[model samples]
Target: MKFGVQYYPEHWPRDRWAVDAKMMQRAGVNVVRMGEFAWSAYEPKEGALDFTWMEEAIALLSSHGIRTILCTCSRTPPPWLYQKHPGIVNCALNGNTQPTDERYRVGLAHGEFIAEAQRIDGAVIRHFAGNKHIVGWQVDNEIGASNDCFCPRCREKFQEHLRQKYSTPGALNEAWGSHFWSYNIEDFSEVPTPHKRAQPLVEYRRFMSGLNVEFSRWRADLIRELDPGKLVTTNYQNIHAQHTDCHALGRTVDVNGMNHYPARTPELAIDYYRGARGEVWCLEQHTRLQHHDTPAGRMRLWAWMAIAHGATGIVYFRWRQCRWGQEQFGDGLLPHSGEENRFYGDLSRIGAEIKHLGDMLAPTRPRAKAAIVFSYESRWSFEASGFDRGLGPVTEAVDFHKALSRRLTAIDAMDPRENLSAYRLVIAPRLWMVDQRIADNLRSFVGQGGTLCLTTASGVVDEYSKSFDTPRPGRLQDLAGVTVSDLAFDKALRLPLASDVIPDLDGEEGSLLADEVHPTGATVIATHAAGWRKGSPAITMHTVGKGRVVYVGVRLSPEAVQTLTNWLCETTGFPKPFELPNGVSACERACDDYTLLFFINYRDDPQNVQVGEGWIDAFTGESVAVAEVPANDLRILRSGK
Candidate 1:
């Protein structure tokens, strides 16, 4: 696997590049990601550009036998460019223009801004594209803005987008459900982002995602035009809910990369990685002492967990910790003194381990048997409005999905259009907003010998962000073999309220979004604790054409959900979770004639494990009846002849 670090040229002196690169090479690091926020250094003026500094930096790394992944350096616009072209500043939805304080503050729709970015991008690519030591290019650092742009250019573009989508103002009005408050429009320009309580929030949310997707596509095209041969990607924030369509974004890039921080548990990071397809990399990993908590295992454990989840490349955010800059972010392998620190020791150990594994993990990919439907549009719409005026179903469902994914072999978030027939189980947890065609496709899947699992608050809204007129749980009610009488709002219930039932509580009682069920030849598996409708069902199951559909009505704790899911997984023929020590994780991948098993132990304690017949350790190159794995270690076992 490729190991690297993301470096800021300004933070370290140009003279130190050669020494840093050599140290990294000695430590088993093979790649370096350069220049995400160096726009000011590269472009000192409007049309004039400079590559002298970058050329020296690249050559220094090449001399050390380290590969470089050059960035376009457009994420943070040069201060001079923003000053000259004020229109490039992004305008917020609240009618406020973003000030020149933070990075990534440029308006994506500004034509002149894009033209200058393209110019600088072409120059950078032309300089480094032919370098033998350069392996790839990163298009943009983190290409997302929190605020929706309300600039004139963005407004005009949104109108054109709506016209292309709806074809007419009447159709747009009907789709957006804009007739509630005597709102009528004759032109696309009449559409405005919902600010207060006046408009349907769902429509505005959809528009934000669509606009971001278009911007991402535009940025990807610019980079591809410059250099198509080298691998290209943009860093994504894993588990972030704002930019929902990352799977769609992944399609536009050569590799999928993520910046992950797992404050809760290592499993959360693994779960998020499993949700994306293609080769994955941790572009920015944390490693330093903290004021709040002790550095987690000196950073080695974190790196191992990422590798366990199939990270092809691992890179830290900094080569040298900053002492007098905004990046005093408390996480660097090297301290400000640039001496070998404790964290550096941890990194060196992990790097040695990777070298030992060598080709075994370098070209391997994760194999799985399950898929989860995760859509940015659906999640944003569900969070837009309506749900007892508090946290919505989508938020709760994401937590639940992450919990369940922790136990599975490989979990991926996929668009419904992606072929899911290969997966033994397909789950749509609280899919509130769905297109009609996709809904029909899901229904057809269950009809044709596929197992589907859905949850409450699903199918309640249609493609245009409008609620169905018939009843709650709209188009999927029939397919789910249940009907809704009323949405039981603000209801909290305890799981396994009866004896002989395992309560689904992590620690406390959880809330349910909606409650109603009229089964049609379906079995009621569980029910609510108490209410006027005390005996109402909370879980149901129905057998369709050649498969079955399971509907969970309320949120359950991870333990409870796993209990139920384990049963289903066994029934559907998914591989059983291999029993391992506390910090040990094992996963298997197979080729036509061979099977490779990855065994990773993230703990500091040694472990003794049985070596099944026909397997040999890839790292130690030893054949034995049984073996003991050392502390903080990883092993790959290939099938023996």
Candidate 2:
């Protein structure tokens, strides 16, 4: 596997390059990612160039046998570019243009913005195209921003995108339910951003996701045009709120990369990697000591967790801690003094292990028995407009996904094009925006002996932002075998599973969104505990064709959700959980000749697992008489005999 680290050349003096490179080689770090936010230094003027410093840094790293992944530095446009072309500035829904203070303040669709990005990307690739040391290129850094664009250029492009999708103004009006307020439009340009008060969520969400996808395509195209051989990717922050669809973005890139902060649990690191489809590179791994009572081996544990989930590379955000800067990120392998720290020792140990593992930890795609249907459009819609309640289905969906990730072998957030037939169980959590075709597909999956799990606040809206006039569950009501009579927007209630199928389900409160369910032809598995709608079905199951469809009417805690998800996985005959201690994680992938298992011990204390005879530990080149692990360690075990 190739190991790389993200670094800022401008932050460290040129003189320190040799020292840093040497240290990296000693630690077995091979690749270094450079220049994501170096626009100011790269292009000082509108049509000027500066590569003297970057060239030297690249050369110094190459001489040390380290490869480089050059970034286009388009994430933050240079102040000169933004000042010269004010049109590139992103305008929020409130009619406010972003200030120069923030990094991602430029609109993606602005013509000048696209032109400037292309120029910079072309220049960087052309300069280093022949350089053997350059391995890949990162297109941008976290493309999606939270706010909606209300600028005239974005507004126009959004209308055009909508027109191409919906076809006519009348069709658009009908889909968005514009007649509710006698708000009918004659042209596409009449469409407006849904405000906090206005509830035209479906259209707004579709527009936002569409915009992001277009931007991703634009950036990927620019980079590919310059260097086709160099793998191109954009780092994605693993959060639902950012509205960046990594799954959709993954289709545009050669490889997938994600930034993770796994302070919550070691399991979260594994989950994030699985979500990104397992071909991942960690852009940022926190490795510093902080005030919070974070566990002692937390960093090591999370790092190993990532490796187990198919990380071909391991890299930290900062090699040296920052002394004075706006970021001043405290986490680094090396302390601010440029001396070896405790974290550095741990990193070196892990790096040595990876080097020893060598080909054993090569890129191995996951073999998933389950799939999760995640839609960027659905997330966009929920954030755009909805019942103004504190707890909503969107938040619940993200929570449920995190919960499911803890137990599943491979859990992927997938687009519609992905094959669902291979999955024994398919889950669609909080899929609010369900068109007829998608609804039909899910029904077919269940009909064809595949388990289907659908959660609450689903099938509420259509593609056009209009609620289904019939009932709450809308298009999926019949397939779910339940008719949602009315939705209690933000009501709180507790419900427990009647059957002792899974442990610990007593008095778990369901908040955010709840519905009054009236089962049409489904078996009631659970009921609500309070309110006038008490005793109403909260969980229902229906046998469809040779399979089954389970509908959850309310959200549950992470633990409770995991219990249910595990039950489904077990029922479908998925693989057993990997054998590892609490702080240790393991993931396995099998090829034609060999089966590789990634084992990571993420604890301060050493962890020991009894591996059956005939498996060799790839890291230490040791033939294990009995399986055991050391503190803060990672290993890959390959078996071919």
Candidate 3:
């Protein structure tokens, strides 16, 4: 595994370079990701490119055994470029042009903007192509972070995209069901930017997602062309960022990278990124609080959490916090004074431990028997439809995942369209947009003996973001063995629900939304205990082939949902290999030769847990049958086969 930090050489003086290099060497830092936001430093003026300073810095770092992961530096274009092409600024959905002063404001769909970005990107790649110390390339710093442009160029491109997708305006109109409001168009160009209409908004969402993928693909291809041997990657933000489809973006890179801020983002964000690819890198890991101080050992704990979820490379966000700029207060391993702090000690300890365990942990990947399926399209479609303001798909998915995480190891939170045959159990929460392909995929997965669990608000829409005329869940009614007869979505309405299959939540009240399910041949596992819709099926189970499908028709309490998730896990016969106490989690990454375990204590109090025999603590190199995990700390262990 690679242990590194993000270093901004341009931010400091030349004399400080060697000092940072020596400090990194002592801390077991092997890599430094640089130049992501340094376009202005590289090209101070138009056509006045300078690579000598960067080359010197790279050479200095290489001398200290620290390699570089150079970034293309196209995301934040220099001020001169923006001044030269002011038209590159993005236009927001409300018809206001975003100022070009902000980072990542270049319109991706703008042809001239692309040409300029490619020019600077190509220059950077060609300049550093032969640099031996550079291991890989980060295409851009979080592609599509601020690239959502609703300008005329984007509208034209969107129209062109729709034309290519439907081949005719009439077909597009029919697919979008635009005739309902007499909104049918005679030409694709007549379609405006995403507005009040559900179909156009969802389609535009998908189109923007595609544009992000295409943008990354272009950069990755350019990198490969310049240096075919080097790996290409781009940093992805939290999973809920709907501008880009991460799974699609991952296909364009050699490896997926993510920015991990445990305080702001959930732990499952790492899993989602890993699921986007197979293994991932923590490209920008928070080492301290923005303004406040991080509790001791918390940074190390978060790093281990990432590794536990299959992070092959862990890079702290920055070596030192910036003294000036927008991120002046964003703390790092070292304080603004460039002095050693608790974060430095924590980082050095983790780095040394990683250096010792790198070989054993490198080959091992996360293997999970169960998965939680997530879809951006489903989320986009549902959000566009404005069914419920509080219905957050990512939050709901995370709730189920957290429940499963208490008992399971390495539960994959991935896209629903990914291969599912390997998983024994799969939970898809709020799968609102179910198309023929999605429906068939779930049917096939369940048919092949995989237990599938789907939650409420599923199967409401088809591929075009249009509601189906048939019963709810659309094409999945037969597979689910139930149809939603009436949806009770009133804020004051709550169902007193009971379940025999999951008896732990019996007599529990469920609210937010409830689908009164009429089971055809399926078994009513749960029903409303007391309500206007009393005795109605709130949860049902159907045995399709060798497998079964469990349908949850209402949003239950977090505790109740957990009980149901645990019931599903038990039903699938998933092995509970690690028996961990509450507030402690054991994540396993195994290879043929050995199994690596990361024990994380999430509470303020110490946690004492018994480890299985033949396990050795990776940090202390001691054989132990019992381990005491400290508060907000982590322990890594390995066992030979």
Candidate 4:
């Protein structure tokens, strides 16, 4: 329940430090994250380094009872270092070296660059190793926000990584299935740069993602060695961010952190990052409007939404907007005039509320009965193949997650390889790429009394992006009890569904992609009601050991997805609490002592909810049978001993 803001003492004049600190303290901000982007300010020249200003700033903030989330500036090195090591520039996909004017232009595998980065990072950590005001370390500012380079050195390193992984050239060839276009390699070095091939492109993505993970781990380990008392973390961009695998990167830090923009990003992103690692933080929570105008109270509501999704701390992006740079128009709590506005008023109100809530919400966690599996490999593979451009894996996953949100059930969105034994229901959307390991995991989940639902375009390729010689779903056909004969790709196909099986899904329209599913041992729950493929199986269900599996062969409408999800919840006996009205959402976090419910009204009009007698509002500490929450507002209630 900590509230904070991103601050940059180096960006402003020396005299403004105490002023900003006093203002933030009055606003109830307990923390300030700084220095992840101030490399040039710290070291103006190549061999010249000074940290006196940073120390002075830290001391000033500490006097006001504000801690610091210090950050390593390896992401953006000073200009002198780049000029000294000109070869460290990244090689773009077009084979030209990217200029070093912008940040993140240095190649990850560059030897000289890595040495210098490590030196600077070690020096920075050693300087503040025992500082009491420094509470945590942010490894880097959005590590791998840009794609990695494809230089010869990186290629050589990737080949070495493959050699270390495969042990032999023959194994590498088999794993990548490089024999399709005479691309088979006799030596590990023979693997060419990524082209139009799916396997190589997917492997390159994995390799680049690994480079990011290794880089973050390097800095995190350095921090641990120098400052073991402080926590280390880095913010992930989003779920569809292809530059780095966040789930893999989460392992390098003590806590998972995310840059959240609820106006543009989905609720699934918050839940995904929350589940990626145990405790999460909104490192760069949105304060100002981006792309769209944020309503008066929506900003604070979004902050609470992050907390409801299990974020331990919420740090707004910035205290004031910059008057210069590319993001000059990017708004913050204070406008360019450095005066408070409506947004600052909203922040002040929420800050007081959070102060009142205090540490009472710290021990609770989001107890979820359903989970959605999201795979980066599958998403990368799908994007590489360019089979269906409009059908994104992230879109499908978010759609299902939104449906679950509409039903007032908190979901754990994470990688498919994560543990699925904790939940009663699991949904995997567009799992286009499946390996034997993932297949076994899903099978085990279904076999152990858990209900599993898989959407269209699932299991179309193996681990190496090669189509299975057998059925379409690769190793999941037997477990799913269905095989695909032909895939319908017509965008205009609004095929009707059967009415009797699920009455709510009756006559629902299906579009985009549809598979002609031939069931082997599964029961055909729904079939096409129109066109030439009339009465064909569009959705099927199979009963396994102690669980059940449902295969959705067509992309159904949003209404249909919700209906199917509701039916699945009912069939699985997972509770779907608090039927929310339109434009309203609710999520719950609980412990043995009590359950806290967060009700948010996203609509422009106020909404009312009927609560039981035992429920008490956390903010107001009032017991009531009914609660009226204003538009773009939120309420937290504690119930059940």
Candidate 5:
């Protein structure tokens, strides 16, 4: 695996470069990611470009056995370019133009902006095309971190996009179901920027979200055309930033990559970005959160967590804290005064450990027999509906993933459209909108002997963000063998629910929304214990073809959900391979030669995991019957297959 640090050579003096390089070499950081936000430094004035400094920096690092992953500097344009073309400045949804001084916020789809970005980007690529030590190219810094523009130009482009998709205003109106408040339009140009309205909002969300993918692909293709051999990728924004569809971006790039903050972002994000590609580079691993100090051991623990979830590369976000900037007290390997602290100690330890374990760990990817499906369209649809809006589709997916990961070795967080042949149990939570393709894919999975679990508030709308004329649970009713009669979504109105398959919560009142499910030919496994809707089915199961479909008609607590996942294994007749203690997890990764399991303890103290037999410590090469993982640390065990 590539062990590296994100270095900003422009931020420091030329003389200090050797000191940082030597420190990196001492710590086993073999690669450095630079130039992510150094456009101004590259081109001090428009048309006055100099790549000599960066070349010197790369050569300096290379002398110490450290390569570079040069990032295209287009994301941070030089000040002069913006001063020349003020029209490219970003505009918010409220019609206010954002200041050009901002780093990432820009009118990404603006014509002049694209031209300028491409100019600088093309220059950077051509300048570094022949660098032998460069291992990869990050197209842009963090593609989805910027806000989507709502300027007049974006309005025009959205209209053209709708015109191409719908072909006619009438068809667009029909698909959007715009007749509710006479929101119908005669021309595609009549559509306004997304601020109100359901259908248009969802379409706008999708359209604007796709711009990130389009932009990344443009850069990636440019890199391949100019510098072809190395990998091309873009670090995605934090998982909570739903502005862009990550799965789509992952598919577009040559390799999937992400900026991961382990403290703030959930661990599922590491697995989510890994997706079908099965490997992701954690481009920006956090050492601290927003000037606050992270716990002593967490930085190393988070790195191992990423590696466990199939991170082929771990590049700490930065090498040094900036002396003066908006992000002054930021996460860095070294403090602002270039002083070594506990962070450096933690960093050196991780570097030393990965230096020994990287080869065996990097070659192996995560393995999962079960998956939790998430959809951007479904999430967008829920956003359009503007109802029952508490925890959104993302929370639902993450929660289910966490619950399953607790019991199972590793659980995949996948897009519904991805391949389902490899998984035996697939949990799709809150599938609010169902397209023909989505419905067909899910139904086929159930038909092909896959246990599919779906939740409430699903199947209310079609792909076009219009209500389905059919019964509730729209396209999945037959496959699920249950039709939703009605739903109760009052957060305070917790119904007393009981389940035979899941553990009892001692009248804790977990089900948030109760769907009065009327099963056509399925078994009712759970029902309302005591309520106005008492005896009504809250959960159901129906055998379909060689498999079955379990329908959760209500949102249950995290504990209840995990218990239900256990029941899924029981029904599928597949025993869970191993179970770890709470606050500890084991991820299985393997190749043709061997299988490895990384036991990670998330608690504050040490924890032990049973290794059974035939397993040797990956680093020590000593057989272990029981492995004790340090607090916020990990132990890797390898077995020849």
Candidate 6:
């Protein structure tokens, strides 16, 4: 329930600290995140280290009842440190990248960078370890974002990782399947750089992602060792980014945190970042992205949307726009002139509403009976193969999530290896890379009477980026009950489903891929309607021990996906949440005492919903029968207990 802004006392003059504090206090901001990117300001010289000014800023905010979410500023080391030490920054295959002013230019596995980061971060932790006003410790500023270092040291570390996984060159070549084209290596040191081959490229990506997690965990473990009581987390970039696996990062930290920008992000990103643990802080909630003037009242609506998806905190990126940095045009609550605008008014209203409703909303989170499984390995495999150009795994996953959310408001988007026993209908979209564990997980879910749906381009390869010598879908071929005779490459097929089975999906347009599925002891649900592919199976389903599995042979549009979701719900008798009109969202969060509903209108016109009885406005305590939400606005209602 923390609400605040990211403040930088070092970025501004010393005299304006009290004014910002007063303004934040008036707006009901209970927290301010600072000191994330101010490494040089703290230690301008090698022997000269000063923290008295930061202490003063903290005290000023604490006097106004504002706490701090201090970040360990290791993402960007002081420029002097880079100048003093050479070969600490990242280097591409060509040469070392310049401009040390940018953040995360250093390699993760570099010894020099790791040593200096630990030194500086350990000092920061000890300095404010006992500060009562400091509520949490953010480990780093979005680990693995804008990070794709391929330096010699990093490459050596990757080679070491490969060496550990496979003891010798023969084992490495066997797993990578690089015997063709005479790419064999005599030793681990002889392994070439990882861009040309699929398996090597995928392994490289896996190595780098693990390195990012390792670096973050180093800081996280350091925080716990030094300061044990406070929560520790690093802000995750948008879920669509394939660099760092959020699932692993979520498990490593105490609570998950995300950088949420609603203008360009989908609702699935918010729910996904709020991982299975269901505790997330929007560490960098967007007010206005660069050059994109968000519509009026949308800021408050976006904040509510985050809360609706189980974000426990909302901290805007900045209180005021920077006047002179690279992001000078970035928008915030107050303009660069330090004057309040419409966005500030929106923030003021939101703060008051949260002040009234945060406690009631704090204990509640989104509960789901439907889930979608995502795999980072599959995304990397897709990237390495280079065939998934127009429709990637992320696109299909996001589209499927949006469709599922239309029918079920609280659908869980999870990793491939997480627990699937909680969901009745689980959808796996374009699971192109299937490992043994993932296959076993899906089998267990379906064997226990949970209905599973898998889309096209699924199970094309095994864990090591090698095509399965057996039938497609690798290990799950029996569970899925279908064999792919041929898969069309990047074809846009026409689907004509059985009208008696699901009438709504008759005129479906399937795109991206088409698989010619031959059912074995299963029923064909749909077929291609056009010439040259007429009567070919486009979708198939089978009943396996007490459950059903559906295989979609082509990519479905969002509307068609929704139709398929509704048909699944009807066929399996899965309990679905109450529905709302298009462009209107109603997400429910409940406890034993009462149930709270967050209503958001994303369209230009207002939306109205009828509650049968016994609903009161959570903010005003007034009984409401029909909730009226204006254009780009939101409402909160509490059910009578």
TM for every model, in the order presented, reads: 0.90, 0.88, 0.97, 0.97, 0.97, 0.97
lDDT of each: 0.68, 0.69, 0.86, 0.85, 0.83, 0.83
**Model 6 agreement with the true structure over 1-641: per-residue lDDT tens digits:** 99999998997898899999988888889999999887788789875777788888998999999999999887788878888886788877575574677777888888888888888888888888888888898988888876677777777888899899989899888887767888888888888778668999889988888978988888888788878899998899886778887778777789899999988888888877875666689999988766775778888888888898888889998899988767788757788888778888888888898898878987888887788887888888877887754466678778878777666657778788899888888888888999999999999999999999998878899889888888876687888898886777655455554434666878877875778787876688877776677777777898999888999988777788888888887777865555577899888777778888888998999888876689998878899889998888888899875
| lDDT score, candidate 1, position 52 | 81
RMSD of each: 3.3, 3.4, 1.5, 1.6, 1.6, 1.7
**Sorted on lDDT, highest at the top, how do the candidates line up?**
3, 4, 5, 6, 2, 1
Give the better candidate number (3 or 6) by lDDT: 3
Choose 2 or 4, whichever is better by lDDT: 4
lDDT of 4 by residue, 520-604 (tens): 9899998889889888899999999999889999998888998898888778886545657788788888788888888888888
**Evaluation by TM-score, superior candidate among 3 and 6:** 3
Q: Which stretches of candidate 6 lie over 4 Å from their true place?
A: 96-98, 491-499, 575-579
Can you write out model 5's per-residue Cα lDDT over 1-641, one digit (the tens) per residue? 88889999999999999999999898889999999888899889988998899999999999999999999877677778878988888888888898777787677788898998888888899889878988899988778677588899999999999999999999998898778788799988898887767788888878888888888888888888878888988888876777888888876678788888988888888878887678889999887776575778788888888888888989998888888877887677788899788888888999999888777776687777788887888887787677644556677777787777766666777789888888899988888888888889998888889999998888889878888887789998898898887877776867667766564633435555767789997898888778677878888899998989989888888877777777887777776546588899888888878898889887888898876889999988998889888887888899943
Best by lDDT: 3
Question: Per-residue CA lDDT of candidate 3, range 334-392, in tens?
Answer: 88889888888988898888888888788999988888897888888888997753585
Poorest stretch of ten by lDDT in candidate 4: 573-582
* lDDT, candidate 1, 166-189, per-residue tens: 899888778766677866789988
Clashing residue pair totals per candidate (backbone < 3 A) = 1, 2, 1, 0, 0, 0
Worst lDDT 10-window in candidate 2: 264-273
Model 2 per-residue lDDT tens digits across residues 95-163: 889887777787777888878877787787678776777888776676676435678777788778778
